[model samples]
Target: MRKSFQKIAKKYALLKQGWSPQQNLFYGFLTYIIIGCILLCLPVSQKISAPILDHLFIATSAVSTTGLVTISIFDTYNGFGQFIIMILIQLGGIGYLTFTTFMLLSTTRKMTLWHKKILSTEFTLPNTIKIKDFLKSVILFTLIMEAIGSILFFIAFKNEGMPTLEAVWSSIFHSVSTFCTAGFSLFNNSFMDYVDNNFINFIISMLAICGSLGFIVITDFGLMIKNKSHELSFTSKIVIYGFLILLTFGTAFFYFLEPSIVNLNDSRFLASFFQCMSAMTTVGFNSVNFGVFSQAMMLVCIFLMYIGASPSGTAGGIKITTLTAVFAIMKSRLRGRSNITFLGRRIPYERLYIATSSFIFYSSIIAIGTFLITLTHNFKFEDILFEVASALGTVGISTGITGDLTTFGKLVIIILMFIGRLGVLTFGLAIWSKTITENERKVLKEDIAV
Candidate 1:
């Protein structure tokens, strides 16, 4: 029996070694989703299951951190099922690679080169050659942020008349979810009831902001504070500045243009601020019905979702850094300059290419997903577009019609969520590997009339 077990293990190990890094990461994510789906399909979850498609939808939503749901979370799933969903959200947000690395760290007490490579890709780090420290930092930072967030939320809930145990659990779940930008909510209508509740909105907004800022920026900030001479990384600086600027503009635009929001009798400032933060961070918790939003406000929300939080963060969308790079590149070209500069630093051509490619890939995926869903569902173009953006951005705001989507529409959304979370470009590249020829022949230049 021992010899057979060893033989099987060796065979699996050999097979795994032959797989590429991208393949391994893709398989790992798929395996996690399959396990989550199976668990969710159990009798415990079936009690709340409206349909098999609904269960799969919720499972995919949680695992992809997309937050799109066919039913109210509070009414649909039991405590056991909700717990499972929360676990999936945490795992999905931190990433399968991060989870595997954590497991290896616990069991073998060491990280191998393979682990570092996976971590690097997951975090979008410069190199995985020396990633043990970064991995530790990522774990520690997440725990600390979630812990503090939970405490704040618990205090707020407790004051609102929630019992001790329930309040604690709610706080813990929401803190983790918000910080991961997973957008799972215990409430049926998200934070709709708390639109004017400054305290709750502020707490959630802060958590969302922290989560979407990315671990790289957090680490850089920490190092800068510790050593006065050590400046923050250029990438971190750009992300911070860009995030603040966008948030400011988004908040102001919504406050002035949206009558539904601006007409609120009390705490209108808080409502506007929270919504702006939510949209910018791709943390889809809404304090009000998004369907009631004016066309101008809806467009603003779409734009904010399109230019989402930083890379290596829990949030999705085209990513703020990418948008910033595109603008910089365009400005430089318009000015007849060869170099794209931001913050007194020249952006590398390679990085610009990456940013451009990411934008193109992200836009293409959203367009395709939107087209497919429209074919199956008899919904308005605006509604379908909203849903597609929500899935692609991993933003949960909806027009209150997600639950009515057909099976085909649901599947289309599930695919969009998965691709968005994994990153459209990364997933595409993983499936289609590119090769360079060793021998290159120079091509003659041909002139054409302009």
Candidate 2:
């Protein structure tokens, strides 16, 4: 057994050497999800007997940090299974590569050339920050933030008369879940029961915001504070400002458009703010029932979900940086500028290409997913569209249709969730490996009609 294990490991290591960093991440996530599914299929892992596919669905959803599930997590999984899921969420959210890097760094601060190359591509880290410092910051920041969030949640649950053990467990589980933007809840209705729960809502929203703001932005913010820098990095500025702008826009729009849906008895501001932040951050928690929302507001939620979260973070999306770049490029083109400049800095052509390409890839996947799902299920266009968007965004806010999906539909959602967790671009590269040598060797250029 040991020989076989060692042999497999050796082959895997050899094969991985030829893979791009993106492919490494792709397989890493896939391998993790498969292992999670196998564990979740164990007799002890589940409270009751369920089909193997259901277990796979739960495992995939947990590993993807996506809350889309056919089973009620609260009822389907035993404490052991729930704990496993929680661990998977945390690992998935922080990324498996990150843990690998930390392990490598613990014994030796120095990273090899190959290690640095993979880390650079995986996290999109700036050259200015050492790999060791970046890994440390990612770990320390996640722990510290999750710890603070847990304390607050524990107090809130204790106040609600939940037992000490359960409260503590719930607090820790939810703090990590919320901060990681996993949104897997022990509650049946997600956060709907806590619509008016001030303490829980506030803490959760804050955690989701911090988590989805992207780790790069968080690290940069820390640097700014430590050095008292006069300004943020261009990427950080775009993320922070764009996030706030989106938050405000979502809140105000939801407040006005869905005034009829808001529970007036509770704090309307809290309801509005919480759902807005939740959707924007791709955190599936919702203080209000989205199904009850007006069509206009539901569409608004879809749009917010589509925009999703920032880059290099727990949350998934086309990313704020990409969208910011796209908008900047449009502005530049309209003004007849020769070069794309943002915040007094010139944007490289490669950067603009990535932004545009990512945008295209996101749209393509969403469209393809929606089309494929419609073939298997007879659902409203809006519901089908919403499901696709939710899966592709890695945002688990469903139109209450996820539970009724057929086997084919479930399979579709699973694929979307997997690709969504790994960016569309990364998926493309993994399936269709590209070579710089080939591109440079071919000098052919063609223009497509605009």
Candidate 3:
């Protein structure tokens, strides 16, 4: 009996010690969602009673930094509840690895090999970049940008005649939200009132752009400045160029396609540019009602959200890097070339594999999510598809269907938002890693036609 007890104890200890980094990331966000849900459920958190599921939905959205909501946040939650949400957004934005690593550094001033392993899994760093530099860059850059954004926002709000205390709180909340690309707004209509307000528009756009650019670009730029001999990495160059091309194209096309822009008159170009920026950055803020957008305009927004922003940042979707790599592969194949190349540079096979995997897995999620939501909701296909793309991209744009979603539809969106925040690739790895085994066997190879 004593031997059996010892055996059981040993098994339990082994189980406790065997969590992989992917597993840690997967379970870490789950814990945050649950805790945030419970806190939002407390009597002090709510201004009025609400369904537990609504609170759970909101909690999941906040922790994922996906701003989809079934209830009005202003009406549902009090100041303390809003504070809880802001904290969750901040945590989700910086990421689980960043938070844990920062805490470790604060307490121990050192990182173990295990911590390094987690960092590697969470971020896709270039060969030239160091993990230490990446972590410091993320934390420091986030602080500085958010600080600057808050001040700008406060000035804009005060100029707009908002009360001083309200402006202060709104500025802080919005600065963090915009920089994080979380898209949570204290305002009920989400900047609709300030649609033509150039100051507010500029501040939000700048914050979102900086947040969505990813830490790689920020770190690379910092290194280049610190060392004159240093140059921007290929990845950074691709991100910047791709960002500009997409932004210019999206704005011009959106301006011509969106009818409401004509109504804005003097603010027509600004409206188009801001909306495109919001979608491309995955920040999800809309100055005008998305419900009024035509199908073509909606498709344009969908494409932007689907591409999302750069990797290793708060923004979701498969990432610009993945999209670029996929295009490079297609270009190479079309040229009858044996090697994949982009911009005269031969692309690595490993990156191609990741890009392909991400594209496939991300598309599969959207299709499945849309179908599942369709099974429960009576909304139009375009509207349903938009919601799925928004949730999966973590962009949070909707065709006014979010609040009316049935419980099942909300649950489907909740799952998509969670997957988006975790990342389609990371989520896949987290699950697949659990099934990996050391034992190897040889297998016969087979070929199939494309």
Candidate 4:
């Protein structure tokens, strides 16, 4: 028996060498999903006894950091099941190996080369050379941010009359969810009751915003505060300026265009502000019924979700930096400039290609996904498009029609959520082990009108 086991282990090790970073991520994600599904199907969750599709849907939802669900989180799953889901959310949000490396570093004070390589790929870091410090920072920053968010949420909940223990639990869960931008909520309506509650809304929104901003930005901000001389990266500057502009414009647009929202005399501003933040960050926690939102508001939400938050964050969509890069490229070209510049710094061509590729790939996936989902469901074109965008953005906001989707439709969404969370390029790269070599021979060039 020992000899046979050794033989099998050796065979597996041989196959592992051919695995690319993308393949590793793909397999690791699948392992998490399978484990999540098994745990969710246990007797504790039997009362919810969702169809297999629902289990896959929720498992995919949790692991992909996409919050779309076919059932009420509070009512459908038992405490045990809810706890399991929360664990998955935490793991999926920050990533599978990020926490593991943190644990190793804390326990042993060193990261093996193999560990660093995995962490680099998982976080999309440019290199794995000095990932120990990065891992440590990620862990420490996550704890501090989540702690602050929890305390503020707890205070807000206490003000709303929740009992001490319940308030604490709610705060902790929400803090993790918000800071990870993973929109899992214990409440059925997802903070709808707290729409006018300034303390809660602001705390949650701030957490979501901070989380959606990449860790690199957080690190740079920390350096700026601590050293007082370190320069912020151009990418950071673009992200900050762009984020502020979008938030301001999106809030005003939603407030003015949606009469149903504006008609809410008491909480009009709060409602509009929260929804704007929610959609732009791709956090997906809704304070109002999306079903009643005007066509204009729906379009606005779709646009926000598509642009999404920053790169290297839990949030999905095309990402803010990518959009900013594309605009910068266009402006430079229109000006007949030799280089793309932002904040007085030239952006690298490699980064520009990545941004352009990401945008095109994201748009293509959404278009294809929308068409596929339409064939499986009887919903209106707008609603179907909204649902597909929500999935691809990892945004959970829905048209109150998710539960009515066919089994096939739900599966399609599950795949979209997985692809969205991992990213389109990463997914493609992970499945293909070898890079395609381009032919060097060039055909005669033809000039085309711009």
Candidate 5:
């Protein structure tokens, strides 16, 4: 009896210690969705009857910050439902751990070392910033930015003859949604009608761009622009440069590509510019129709969406740093350089492996998701590819097929969105963390024919 009790106690201890960072994140997101779904399914949250599956779908999309939806938001949900979604977006945008950490600190003034590890990973903090400081900065940045965005949007909406109270609600809702990079629009066509409105276009684009810049970059803003001479981190440099390049090229290419499908006489450069920002940032606001875009234009959007946004932001995708690292690695190999170098400095081998591994894992899923989705529907290959790319990137710009997908197709997309939001490798690690055993085995490498 004593031996059996000891064995049981040992097993319980091992299980207790088995929870990994990845597992916590995965479970955290799942818990968020479950709660969101239940709340959304309540009678007070909906304007009309909604199926349970739809509720789950919307809840997942909201928490993931992906704008993909099976139904219309304004038509199907009442104000309360919209409010709930915005709350979920806020929770998801800055992240669950961030909010919880702040609350814990406020109420208890303490967090365990284990919590610090999770918060550090969640916010992508470096050793320079403590977890408490990072969480406070994140909250302060979000609130300030959201406030400024709301004021701008309010002015724009009021000028358009929106009622005073309605304008206030719209401004606040959109400000939070856009800045969070959660593209749940109250409008039907998603800023399609406001394509020519410079103020709306300018403000929303800026808000999304800021949100996609990531918390680390935001936290380093002081160092980046200080008149007192401060050094910016390497990660910030890569994100800023990469983000600018994508915006420039995406806008120019989109503008030039317009003549391929439609006459370029009245080309909407502003619309093109907005789409570029929205796609690269993984904020799915569209000032134009997806159906109107030619295959080439769709391809451009797909590429940008696949690249997604910077690390640790509300946006999701392969990430700017990952792609930047992958390209740098490629250039180095082509030049026969001894080390992977970008700009003037050499990147560590560990970073290179991480970038490569991230690329491989994300790319592998593209194929798997595409195949699984195509099997469930008869959609064209290109459309399916675009859908998969958008889903995996967490950019909700659909080719207009989201509403028609079968149950299996929706399941595939839900899985993609979940993984895309948490990221590919992290989700895989979360699953792998189920079993904890240290292995230091070595295996011989062999070359095989390509």
Candidate 6:
């Protein structure tokens, strides 16, 4: 068995040699989803029979770390099935290349050039950060944070009179789910029962935030603590500040402007902040039913989801950094300034180009996805838009229309979730990008109207 496994591994390694990093990542995630779907289809994995499409959807959702579900996970799947999901969540959260690189580093004590290229493709790290440190930190921090969250979750669940064994399992599952920002809750209502429970609310929120903040910020802080002379990088600063501003603005908007949340008898602020955080972090855990949300509030949530937490994190979307660049470009163009700048720092043209491309491409995906869904499903305009944004953002909190989605709608969302998880830019490159030889490359200068 061991020799056979080694032979298969060798064959797979040979196959990967010719593939680009994007292709590797794209196919790696696809492989995980396929395996997960197959496992979920087994008789032992189901509590009751379900459509193969629903199982495929759940597998995609879990593997992408997007929480949109066409069926009740708790009612449909048994313990073993849930375990498979948790594993998928962890894999998606940490990323496809993380474990592979980590194992290579452990056994060989060095990364192959191909491995470095793949890591760089997966994570856009600053020049100052080393891949070795980043990989180690990603693994170490994920384990540490998830561990702490599990302990607290266990305590909270036990205090609420959950059975010992159940609490233990729930704690582990919720901890991984929240930390990964997968938001695949065992509960039917998704934390609605614990709206007023501060301990649960706080723990879940922090876990998601930590995940969404991106490893750049986390690793920056870690380095800062270890070496006092080290300063936080510009990228880290932008991600941190952008996340804070969105969180504060979203929370206040929900509390003051959303009637249903403002009308809550108590813990109104908590509910507002948690919902906002869920969207911003792309965690998808909701303390409130989005069905009661006004159109205006839904719009606000859509905006939050549109510019998700940060890059190189478990969370997905165009990302805060891209949003910042787009804003800077707008600000500069409005003032007729020749160069774009944000927060007193001039943005490089290369970075600005990538950011602008990402902004345009991301927006296009959402628009196209929404338009496609509209053709098939008879749902509210805002609800359809929200669903598209959520799927594209991989922020799975929805307005209770997921199960009712037509088969076509479900397929659209599944595609969006897959694209979102790989990232709009990554997926686009995988499908349309190609290497251009210098000898064949040509530069054409042209000007176009704005």
Question: Using Cα atoms with residue i matched to residue i, what is each candidate's TM-score against the true structure?
Answer: 0.93, 0.96, 0.95, 0.92, 0.92, 0.97
Q: Judged by lDDT relative to the true structure, which candidate is superior, 1 or 5?
A: 5
Model 5 Cα lDDT, one tens digit per residue, 340-404: 99998888898788789989999999999999988889988889998889888988888789889
Q: Report the lDDT tens digits of candidate 6 across residue range 114-221.
A: 888888998988877898988988999999999999999999999999999999999999999999999899999999999999999999999999999999888999
Encode model 4's per-residue lDDT on 1-450: one tens digit a residue.
999999999987666555776777787788898899898878777555667678878988998888899877777788778888888888888886788878888898988766666566666543322466556656778889999999999999999999998898888888988888878899988888887888988998888998888776776677677778777766677778888999999999978888878888889989988998988888889998888888878989999999998877778888888898899899999999999987677888988998898889889999999999887777888898899999999988898788888878888899999998888888877875475456534456789997
For residues 1-450, could you state the per-residue lDDT of candidate 2 as single tens digits?
999999999998989888888888788889988888898889888888788788888878888888888988879888999999999999888886787778778877667766776667667655445567667778989999999999999999999999999999899999998988988999988888778888888899889988998888877777777788535667777788888899899888877679654546456878888888888888888777777677788888888888877788878878888888898898999999989988888888988898899999999999999999888889888889988888888888888999899998899999999998888887898889777796688898889998
Clashing pairs in 6: none
Which ranges of candidate 3 are over 4 A from the true structure?
Answer: 1-17, 435-440
Q: Model 5, poorest ten-residue lDDT window?
A: 258-267
Per-model CA lDDT versus the true structure:
0.82, 0.84, 0.89, 0.83, 0.85, 0.93
Give the runs in model 1 whose Cα sits over 4 Å from its true position: 1-9, 103-109, 126-130, 434-450
Cα lDDT of model 5 overall?
0.85
3 versus 4: better TM-score goes to: 3
User: Order the candidates by TM-score, highest first — what do you get?
Assistant: 6, 2, 3, 1, 4, 5
Q: Is candidate 5 or candidate 6 better by TM-score?
A: 6
Runs in model 5 with CA error above 4 Å? 1-18, 106-110, 126-130, 223-229, 260-267, 434-450
| Order of candidate numbers by lDDT, starting with the best | 6, 3, 5, 2, 4, 1
For 1-450, candidate 1 gives per-residue lDDT tens digits of 999999999998787677666666677777777788888778786445566677778877887787889977777777788889899989888876786677688799888777766666666754322366556666788899999999999999998899999999999999988998989999988988878777888789888898899877877766667678867777787889999999998888878888988888576777788888888888889887788888778888888888889888889888888998999998988989988997678988988998999999888887898889888888877788888998889888888779888778888888888887778777887798656555434556799996
Q: Give the TM-score of candidate 3.
A: 0.95
Better of 2 and 6 by TM-score: 6
After superposing candidate 2 on the true structure, give the runs of residues whose Cα lies further than 4 Å from its correct spot.
Answer: 1-4, 229-231, 263-265, 436-440
TM match of model 6 to true structure: 0.97
